[model samples]
Target: MTGGVVFDPLLPWPLIATLGLVALIGVTLALWRGLSGWALRALAAIALLGALAGPVYRVEDRKPLSDIVVMVEDASASQNLSDRPAQMQAAAEALAAEIEARPHTELRRVTVPDGAGDEGTRLLETLAEALAEEPQGRIAGIIALSDGRVHDIDRAPPLPAPLHLLLTGRESDWDRRLIVTNAPAFAIIGEPVILTLRVEDSGAVPQTANIAPLEISVDGGAAQRFEIPTGRDIDLPLTLPHGGRNVIQFTVPEAEGEITARNNTALVQINGVRDRLRVLLVSGEPHAGGRIWRNLLKSDSSVDLVHFTILRPPDKQDGVPVDELSLIAFPTRELFLEKIDDFDLIIFDRYKRRGILPASYLENVANYVRQGGAVLVAAGPDFASADSIWRSPLGAILPAEPSARVIEQPYHPALTDLGQRHPVTADLQGEENWGSWLRQIEIETTSGDVLMQGVEDRPLLILDRVEQGRVALLASDQAWLWNRGFEGGGPQLDLLRRLAHWMMKEPELEEETLWAEATGQRMRIVRRSLGDEVGAVTVTRPDGKTLDLALEQVAPGRFEALYDGPEIGLYRLQEGDQKTVIGLGPAAPREFEQTIATGEVMEPLIAPTRGGILRLEEGLPRLREVRAGRPAAGRGWIGLTPRDAYETRDVRQTPLLPAWAMLLLAAGLITGGWLREGRR
Candidate 1:
């Protein structure tokens, strides 16, 4: 209980003061005039003045509250490294026990787990939330058991008491990490792009660890090794092998005594894009469908088209001189022999053998296909003639042979069973609403998969693979009828585009492949194949663990399975001969970025509160009580300030003097002063 004197005035203070002043002056005059009762008069004036200024005694009933000490346990992924988990558990238990032993102190524990994705250790944010929930005055101190590698330090809250850090890792702990400081998200194919990387050593690194062996791999291919010096950035020149997502893995073999290999390997995914597409369009004669090929190739701003038409053969009598006739001689030598490799795709539109291109030039074309080149043949009536290009050396690479027959009935083109699953024709819109074609060349399939059929189910589209290249045969040249919306137009543009890209070796258009797409920790694994069914894919995790994941067919040839990965790193996928690598989260998780434990990150936040950082590996510091505004940490001990906080249960107020008592005292003093004056 506590008591204090308070006032409740009966009259205005100004009026009371004026009356007292007048009475004091009267008494002074009486004393100056030799009045003996002046002292009594002064006493009477004091009694009346005191009554007007009321005084009361106040009391409060109180209950003491315990001081709260917030202890934040950093249970993040980084704290699980090496022996830190053991250290954290030991420190936490010791601190809790000490707080419980101290009188008038309570321990509030907050455990911070790993943040979502690569947000890293959110120790400061967790601390701020704990502080906001408690009374600031009742909080004696704030303690964190962490490696001090907090990602959200800027969010540290204002401290009401000292903030102490019980650092978790040992001073001798070291780590080697591979960091990709600069990597472009998209790079031009066949053009060198610079990737900046560094192999860094942290903590107590050995002198012999200055030079490290680095391995680099693209799309899970063979790795190339190099000796690189640590602590400096190395610029690596990389040219993407294909157009699509290219996964590049950079690794520095784990040093003998380093903390983890997780940080030693970094994965970077760059999308490869073509700078320009060079196409050579060779037309045997000017026909209606010739413009369709020209229009399709010209529509894309990225394509460079070189078109040549054999208007008159060398054997034909033109009846006009070469100079008088407005015709440019075809650069047969430059196109077929010299610069054939410069073009990404070669298209033969209704092209038939003429005296102009000899058998040698045609043979060269066949060689081009076998040496990683693409050839697309669009057959017309000429394809079934005696002079058909199929009769030349190029027929060796051609997927089909002309049967010397032509179907002249209007028939709608339809996808074969294989075409419905092939990337070139799968999921094509408006398939049921396609227009009809006037004619198709009869052909006998010698090799390759038949994707489409026409008139009496004859092969209309055939795709094949030559040694290192690709070849495609379309038996009809009347696909332009679809472009003209005969009966109803079809997806001519889409079909042609997919066919062209597939021949050019676009990664997404491959007939058989394995790949993965990641959203947060969830991965969608996809398998594209031409067979009826594919076996389960074997997934190799970053930690050398393997699992067989079964896939369900979502489309004709597309199979998929969803997996929620528990960790962040590169994952290797394999189905049969197809293999691919995908990264689930960041190549290097933020928690493992700086695995070596240190207190530097928390020093600034702790210093202002006069707190100290002690390593748990050395020993758990003894807890002690210290006064506010003084240093809360010492050589072998940490301190918490005791807050003398209390709650008022009840309050009571009593007047010092009652109204009746004040009146009686005033009357008595006045009467006494009157009698004394009479006697005087």
Candidate 2:
């Protein structure tokens, strides 16, 4: 209970002050006139004025409240390294016991986990939330048990008391981390791309650990090793082997005394893109469908087209002289023999062998396909004649042979069972609404998968692999009829584009592929194949643990399975002969980016609160009580300010003097003054 005297005015303060001034003036006048009862009159005026100014005594019933101490436990991934988890656990238990032992204090324990995805440790954010939920006046102090590798330090809340950090890791702990400071999202294939990276050593790094061995692997291929010095940025010049996502893994062997090898490796994914696609379009004769190939290739700004038409063959004996004719001679030697490899894809549109390209030039074309080149053949009715290019040496690389037959009936082109699953024709839109083709060349598929069929279910499209290259055969040259919207136009553009890209070895268009994509820690493993079913994929985690995941057929030839990776790092996936590597989160998660524990990040927030950082290596500091403005940490102890907070249960007020008592006293003083004056 507490008591204090307070004023409860009977009238307005200004009115009371005016009346008291008037009474004081009357008393002073009486005294100036030498009145015998001047002292008695003054006494009477004082009694009346005191009665008018109401004074009361107040008493409050008070209850003491317990002070709250917020303790944030950093259970993030970084705190799990080495013996930090044990250290943190021990400190937390000790702190909890201390709070319970205190006379009037409570503990608010908050456990901070790893942030979703690569957001890292959100210790400060968690602390802020805890502080917001608790009453500020009752909070005594804030404490965090962590490695101090918090990622969200900028979100520190306004501290109501001293904030202390009990650092979790040992002083001798060390780590080696790979940092990719500069990696482009997209890089031109075959052109050297400069990637900036640095290998860093933190904590108590050894003197002999100045140089580290760095191994680099692209697309999960064999790694190339190099000796690189630490503590400096190295510019790595790399050319991607193929287009699409190129997963390049850079690893530094874990040093002898390093805390973990997780940070020693980093994965950088760069999409490889071609500078430009060079296409050689060879037209045997000027036909209606010849412009279709030209238009399709010309539509894409990335394709560089070189078109040559045999307008007037050497056998055409028109009376026009060579000088008078506007025809430019086809550079057979430059295109087929000398610079064939310069083109990424070569298209033969209705091309039939005239005396134009000799057997030697055709043989060189076949060799070009064998030496990692791409060839696409669009056959016309002439392909069934004796003049067909199938009679040439290039037929060896072609997937189909001409059957000396032509189908003239109009028929809608349809995807075969394999084509429905093949990337080139898989799920192509508006297949049922496709227009009809008036003509198709009959052919027997000698090799490769038949992707499409024409009249009487003859092979319309065939794709094959030749040694290190690729070849595609489209039996009909009348696909331009779809372009003209006969009945209803089909996905001609999409089909041709996919077919061309597939032959050019685009990774997305491959018939057999294995890859994984990640959103946060969850991954979608995809398997694309031409076969009826694929075997289960074996997933190898960064820790070398392996698990076989069976996939469900989502599409005809596409199988997929969802996996939630336990941690962030490079994951290797393999199904049969197809193998791929993907990084789930960041190559080096934020937790492992700085495995060595330090108090530098929390120092700024701690200083203003007069709090100290105590390393667990020095042992857990004893908890003590200190005043709010004083330093809250000493050599072997940390302090929490005791907030003398209380709750008021009840309050009572009593008048110091009653109105009747004040009136009686005033009347007595006045009578005494009158009697004295009468005697005088």
Candidate 3:
């Protein structure tokens, strides 16, 4: 469709120059010698030489592509917190209208969604993806309408053109939030753990009260009153009443003219564990099993055991008088009544009906069990006799009735099915290192969990709970052999330690309880049990949304799950009937503003663009164009970075001269000049 003049030289420049010199000499000689014909011939030869050079004419047509302008808009949770969303919407509408009015300029609008679940906002990533779809030369510029708080700033790509930001929000915006500075994942029961908290004031607080009354509650109980100085950190020491996940809620009463009460109250869950256990062991008569119980409990450092043994009876007549017997009088009333609540656990080791403890005292002991007290009875042959303690008023609290039957046999201690299912006894099953108890006492019972059995399938250990109290009955009187290392005795201390602690309403004894411990954003969900199987666990988030997930058993009685909380707040866990709530982040962190618009955050970035940061409070400005690189906003028009690009299929080019025509004109002129000179 088009052509142009181009050169194609066949000879070197030196040969061409030599040919020109010879033609010039011939023309000069003819003119000087008066030979006009010779001069004409020389000029013709020179022109013919110049015609050998190649030339052509070329023409072309071209098409121009439109320049692209990217408009990125951010509408996240933070943006919505203020009037930023409406501002962005208005700015976007006006910008679109302006870009549309421009000639040969295309607009690419990219809307970035809120970042995935608490990751904040990502605007640059969306912009980069939109840019990749188009050619770099076609892009004019990028304009972002948002608050500057971008969660994914690393995603910003190198811009081929200028980048501009249009900020949102006012200059005086601020916020206040509750911060839980310190909380432990675990604390000792009935022991105070120090928690650090702070109430911060941000921006313009309407009411500045010096002291704010803070109410603290544990496990949904009545809150206790405390006064904390506002705008400062306060350390509070709280004691846990019971073991397990202890939910503590701390709240500040709303003040007049307060901005928000959402951050006033915060929930914290601290798991309660036992630092030490106090146990009282009373023996009516010395027996092998009684000594074993004493040795097991006494060996543990965390267990404070107060053991009393009655070596003498009150009415016994002997050669030695009562005063000379030197036996300390057992303070039955003081121990069984006055100081009963002080001890966490009481064990009757082979105790029988003695004249020392009256019927009323035994009745009081039974009442103690009904009132959340823990009692463990170790029975011997005396249990089957007329002197059995089961015949006393304490009989009502006994897990089993002593029958007048004695089963004398050597048998290995075993775990029953329900015992293997219970948290306290399940850990004893399949243990290879424990020596078998050779002797056991026969018992009859309609209730109580049969945790261990002896030879011939006679129950050896029984455990039960009445009211809020716990009871453990060991039917064997020959367990002392294991404690004395009679035949490779093993783990005697460990077994008794677990048994006593479990009876004292320990948190670890719960067969099914949901508990979560957190460190920063990382959380560990643990389920302690004595059962062989547990159903799926359902976790409730702070937002009241429930997530059901199956758990993996890590050990015989422990199941655990690890999770990272998306945002800091209280979270609940449930498995079947067991449910526990724990705080992942602060009941409220100072920074959890849910709105996603980035107008406030982007103000600094927008300042460099020389663009006016106007609110949607005002009407949207019409888009106007200024010079490509100069100030874009002078009067009414906005500036856009220019991207110059053009395409061509054909081009036209002109040559300076034609070789044959030049040769003819040169020969004629030389002949004329030579003839004139020769005539003169």
Candidate 4:
């Protein structure tokens, strides 16, 4: 119990001061006049004033509260590398033991884990959260055990006492980090795009004059090695071979005495976009559905369509001026023979051979197909005639031959079993209730996989690969009915777009392909195939370990597998002839961005509190108590302030003396003074 004397004034402070002042002035005047009883008068005045100023002795039953000393532990991913984890654990245990042994100190251990996404070690955030639960007055000190490479130092809370850092990692450690300073998100296909990168050496960098050899690979192809100077940016020129996403990986081989090689490699995903798609739309006869093909190609901003249409049949042309006839002025030789290979897709919409494109020009178009080009034939009534384009030199590459018979009945289009597996028609079950087509040219399948079928399950659409190129034959001209939204229409736009992309050899629209996408540590593996069943996929991790995972069929021709990734790096997947490489998370993780830990980031925060930054390499320091604002750290010891905080459980108060006793005492003193003056 503790007690102290406190004043409880009977009157207001101002009134008490007035009465005291008047009594004092009277006493001083009597003393100046040499009165004999001035001393007794002064003593009486003092007694009266003391009675007016009420005084009480207060006693408090106190309980001492422990001062809280926060011990922040860094268990982030970076700490897991090398021997930092061991060092941190050792320091934590020693500090916890010492704090618990202290007289009135509590240890609060807060473990900081890895941050979300790219946010690195968040030690200050974790420290502040732990402190929010404790009383600030009792937070005597904050001690953190980390590599000191904190990413959120600005969030350091207001420290009432000293904050000491027990840094982990050794001074001789070193690391090499790869920095992708600049990379383009989109690049034109077949064009060289520049990527700027740098290689940095940190912490006790090796004394070497040799240049660093860097290896670069595009789309998981063979890596090309180049020697580059260390600690400087280098511009790399790369060309994308395909028109789709391209994963480029840059790596530097490990050397001796490095902390880790995790940061020595980096990944950059660049999308390969074609400059412009040149499409040639040739019409043998203009009809109601001719505008449908034109509108589809014209709507896309990327497509450059060159349309040449014969407005009227040559045999039925009325007497119009030769110059007025658009067909008379058409340039057919220049398109078919001169720049036939320049076009990515050549669409023959309802075109019949009527001496427009000569036999030699038709042969050139067939040669274009064999030399890695695309052709799409949209057949109509003219396909059944003797002048059919299929009967020309192009018939060598056509997938279907006209049977000279056309089904004129209305029938809904259907996907064949192989069509359901093909990427172009997969997931089209939602559009099964499509509007009927009034006409479909009967054809005999020669070579190719039939996708769409018309009346009696006859071939409506046939896709085939010739040599190094691809071709698509649509045996009907009634697809435009769906574009008019007849009977709630169908996926006309989707089907046409996929069909065009498939003919253009878009990577994502390939029928037989393997790909994977990663989020955090989980991977979603997908395989698209036209076969009945796909074989198991073999996945190669970043560490070169291989695992074969059986894929489950989620939908027709769609196979998937989910694998929990173990590390952050490039993953290679292969199924049949399909092979793809994808990077999970960052190629160089944020944890190892600065593996060689130092207290540079944290020194400023601790210096303001007179705390010291000590390395745990020399072992955990001896904990001691010290006064606030004093130097709390030395060569071998760290100090924590004792808050000496206490809680008052119960309090009692008693007057120094009773009011009646004070009054009686004052009367006796006054009477004595009166008697002495009377004697005088």
Q: After superposition, how far is residue 383 of candidate 1 from its true place, in Å?
A: 0.5
Give lDDT per model, in order: 0.91, 0.90, 0.73, 0.88
In candidate 1, what are the lDDT values of residues 129-165, reduced to their tens digit?
8889999989999999999999998988899999999
Provide backbone clash counts, one per model. 0, 0, 38, 0
Off by over 4 Å in 1: 6-54, 663-680
lDDT of 4 by residue, 314-415 (tens): 566578877765455568778988888889999999999887678999999989999999999999988999989988999999998998998898888988
Instruction: Give me the candidate number with maximum lDDT.
Output: 1
**Candidate 2 residue-wise lDDT, 86-175, digit = tens:** 878888998899898889989899999999878999998889888889889999998889888888888888999999998988888888
Instruction: Supply candidate 4's per-residue lDDT for 456.
Output: 96
Better of 1 and 3 by lDDT: 1
For all the candidates, what are their Cα RMSDs to the real structure? 3.3, 2.9, 8.9, 3.6
lDDT of 3 by residue, 1-680 (tens): 53456755446767777877787887687668766476556657656665655454556676777888999887655566556777788788878887888889999999887666456677878887999898998887778777667867666676666566666765454445556689999999878899998876554555556677888888656889987777888898989998877899887776665544557778877778778778889887776566777777877787888889988777666778667766787988789889988888999888888788889888888888888989998888888889898899878878888777877765667677666666776666345666767666778875777877776777778888888788888887776767787556765666677788878877767666667788877788888766777877787776668887777888766788888777667776788777777776557543343222245554444445554444434444445454455554434334576676667766766555576577678767677765765686
Among all windows of ten consecutive residues in candidate 2, which has the lowest summed lDDT? 584-593
- Model 4 lDDT on a 0 to 1 scale: 0.88
Model 2's C-alpha root-mean-square deviation from the true structure amounts to 2.9
How far is 337's C-alpha from truth in model 4 (Å)? 3.0
Model 3 lDDT at residue 659: 64
**TM-scores for all predictions:** 0.92, 0.92, 0.69, 0.88
Which residue pairs overlap in candidate 2's backbone?
none
